[model samples]
Target: MMRREFLRGTFGVAGASLLSEVATGLSGGGAVVAAPKSKITGGTIDLREFHRMRRFADLSMGRIAYVERGKGPVALFLHGFPLNGYQWRGALERLSPYRRCIAADFMGLGYSEVPENADISIPAQADMLAALLDHLKIDEVDLVANDSGGLTAQLFVARHGSRVRSLLLTNCDVDENSPPPAFLPVIQLGHQPGAADKFIAPQVADKNFARTDKGLGIAYTHPAQLTDEAIDCYFGPLVSSPARKEQFSRFLLALEPNLLVPIRSQLKEFRKPVHIVWATDDIFFGVEWAEWLDRTLPGSRGVRRVEGAKLFFPEEMPDVIAEEAKALWGVSRSPGGSL
Candidate 1:
């Protein structure tokens, strides 16, 4: 079935709204720049399409791999740690018709190739994003992020608030919530030698293991439904080589010392429209954090709680993200198209 038809069938008209035409001046910049529309509009995106469309931007840090689709204003998608741009594949597919969605792999993760000594800290990741945007000639974006990506998004707002038009954050770090106590065990393991080989390699080697509590399964609402292809795409690169494993370990260790604490003042000062979506069942980030964000951000639109959803719920339930993103972007359905 066509992507639009399939989404419409799955979520009624609300889903089809994702593909409808958007207003020309939604970004608050001048008119939205036009780009070629997608030719293929059917079927789900797979590993093959991911590889075929992947592009790279060489910066001072290293090679950053990313995928871009859609047209009009840009919406930058940030993925969680231990995962990459593939996490937002569903969001990219669904929202492409309305926005130029770009999902980039952070350094030391996914397809982004960085030096062995590269600093993969959260702040550094935010800097890389700024450089990436500059390279792409994108002046502003609607930020959509999850997990550590949310943390990075906050830092991005703190340092480069002018470049952001809006933000949509899912279950992630906030203020003292950075490196939540529940994540200490993983950080400890990451600090150990050969952590990736011991903890990460096994998950990639045994796809079923990834669906268990011992692996990625702990974060997803429906781990059993996670495909083998996704396992390879998400975990394969983490343990691809000794350097990659070390980089992955460094990424976890860098999360310490609570980077978001100092940014509270900046968050309070930010006046851009913000939305916080939290997963109730997520043990790492509770609903209180979302409430905290709503109170902290002056322009916060408020929080949307997802009952029983886990940390990675955004990956499984892209429709919810689409709905929230459309609402945040001031997109409304009309007989002519979207406004």
Candidate 2:
């Protein structure tokens, strides 16, 4: 059925008539019920088409789940911990007009499969990304990363500087000594046998700020804007499979005791044009860390904030991110660039 017809049948004046017609048609071995096309939000773009989308490539780890769309210079996105590439849906929509935005579910998150007994360290994740790029025949691309993915992106650029054209980092843990207090327990637990899994499992559903409940207001600037459906989308993957929670637990454990040692010595020399986009009210990785990052990375651009945005700025202010990315790409802002 056509999209308008489908919508009309599902939620329009002829709802009952359409349902009866569809049921009778199906019963009589006629046309099958056609699913409605997923609608795009903000009249921007349809995100359902991108979730767990696949690419034909043979990397060491096999098929990976990534969403690649638009057509221009390639812009690669890596999401933070406890979240998947789905977090980039809004940003992707805004930037798609000017770039071929590719967002991937890092191994063990979203639809990507984590290898059993594989190294879950930041360096290992960087290597995986490199291999995937080689397999896909992508020589270089602009890199945008958030949270732990920022750390991973930095490591990747440090290891493969030639492959990175530019960098955009947001609210990520950059300083080794400044790990969030909320994550401290997880770090400590990883040192103990079987402690990692136990700690992360319960906290997955707590809905409290990772650092402190007090920061929830800052993290979620507009808490009322959040809906049950949105929360479900964000948290569903954590509980989607029995192995997901365990795998995530292992990944977080692998990150403890500092995951940046492999690339620490090289970060000071990473002179790529880097932009530090941060939220002023971030609770997890505070704004102070952004200053440290700017000072440490030579010639790094200073910090910029999304007014009233939280740690999850990609979701909260995708347009702001898109505008920043567009400026980085040296393009004029498009109609959808403003949040």
Candidate 3:
């Protein structure tokens, strides 16, 4: 069944209205509504009471929307492009109680404020991440990153190595694989006038249109698994302003592998703990790269590969992420608690 149909069948009018309000609120002006229970692709995760959504101003960079939970040591999660902290809901639900879990929407994406000058490069995001940590008064954190977030994490750790206690990198751009083959053309299109809007806007505006070749359909292991809530959760932030479109386009345009050169040098001698959870079938970043990473970083404990998962495994396979998080951080579940 289509996700929209399932949503209508499951909650009828009230659910649909709540989703609309949340989406509207994310854009700019509307009443904020939190779901009692957020349904994943087909199931539900009880997140109503635990979730904390707020916006924090980062000096001159504008406000960044973030999701937070738990109360122990901080474990900050950085999401990739075209998505937000919403992607880490499952992990946040699982680990927040044991550790402070925080996930932020990158400056121009997700629910964050879209500044007139949207800085969306890897370095820019890394800078914004530092600002966020400072704003929250979090001096150090165990960092977890996936997809493009991994790249940003690399830059963040490289530039501000002291702030990171441990690092977890999932399937993402590494070395010379900044813009994967499938996304190269899309990134190229962003450089042109009005081209980014033509390609990016339609997918967000229409639900069914998002599940085709033009959108994120190809990135998922199975395109049919996408939910309307997920799409709107991601799309609402971008559709809210024209500046956000430019930000997305600029992020693609700024893809450069050379930027990671410093990270290689920094991570080589670094003694901090590092773990990897990779998707074996990811077309963008192959397992071979994971093998390369394991050997390069002195802190790398090991590499764990997940078969049959794709680029978006953090969301698609959140249980896997939680398991890996537990293993990486040596976290033990509390009595009767489960991920």
Candidate 4:
């Protein structure tokens, strides 16, 4: 079936937030591998020790690894590219005590197993997520997606919106603006033979790739704060082997043309609430895109910017993300977020 057909087939119109067309202008577009295993929150624990908490789920393609915590209605998190579910650690840690938080490693990215002949694209990721929710018998959830996962969130809602209780989107692809140009180099690396190796070597040899744009630099305004330990949590598993590199390359190459265009029309049919937490300084996706989202997604709560933060603002400002999530669920601070 075509993409729109799939979306319309899966979802029923739903009700839920806050944006009408913005009076402002806009632009738009929009990883993990890490080791030394620790929990995903705030980079405080040893990744090795933390990752011990991950569990796997059997899916059609393969097993998906995930970290589950807290209690209440489910709050599922979808991470961006080249990274695993660990990217959601900070927010998960904060949000879990109230609502259940489950962050999964996309098939093959972290502890998840890769299925043979996997499409490895945004739509596939959405299918995987839907399968996971169904496997677990979850009916609806508050969905929070970042980076490329944001695109997946849009597709999921378009096709299976009833599954989404609400949505929180961070800096990511919007409408026609996707795979932001700043990130084109990583995709280009996948096109050339041995080019991915050049990018991978520095990361493995000395973890020096963290200093490069494709590494930690492009995503953080304060890249210096991403200590070697923190960087290890983000890149180690991604470049764990040559096969993994090829897998990563295929994932990059899978960004099919017109992947997001269809969502433009479908989203108009969306009535659920949406909350946009963006990093204004992110060159890949600027405020214009956020405004476009505010205008396009009638459910939007309005866009909030994390001043001075870049792409990985979720990691850099986890508390803010958690708080925003709480507000989205109408949970207030004091003891913990409401369930």
Candidate 1: how large is its RMSD?
A: 11.9
- Assess every candidate by TM-score: 0.86, 0.75, 0.82, 0.83
Worst 10 residues of 2 by lDDT: 22-31
lDDT of 3 by residue, 1-339 (tens): 222332232211222211221112112111212221222433234333313355466566877778787787899998876778877878887777668899988876777775667666779889888988898889998999988888888888888999998898888877767665545655655677654466656776776767643356645656566776677777766756667767766766777445776567887766789888776556567776777778888888777776555677777667677777887777666623443
- Between candidates 1 and 2, the one scoring higher on lDDT is 1
lDDT score, candidate 3, position 222: 60
**Shift in Å, residue 29, candidate 3:** 51
Worst lDDT window (10 residues) for model 3? Answer: 21-30
> Candidate 4's residue-wise lDDT over 67-156, tens digit each?
888777999998877567777777777787768899888764766777546667777878898999999899999999888878788889
lDDT for model 4 comes to 0.70
**Model 2 alpha-carbon miss at residue 57, Å:** 4.8
Which ranking of candidates, highest lDDT first? Answer: 1, 4, 3, 2
TM-score of 2: 0.75
| Candidate 1 lDDT | 0.80
lDDT of 2 by residue, 62-151 (tens): 456777778767899999766677778788877887888888877766667665555666777888888878876788889999988887
For model 4, state the Cα shift of residue 69 in Å: 0.7
Q: Which candidate number has the best lDDT?
A: 1
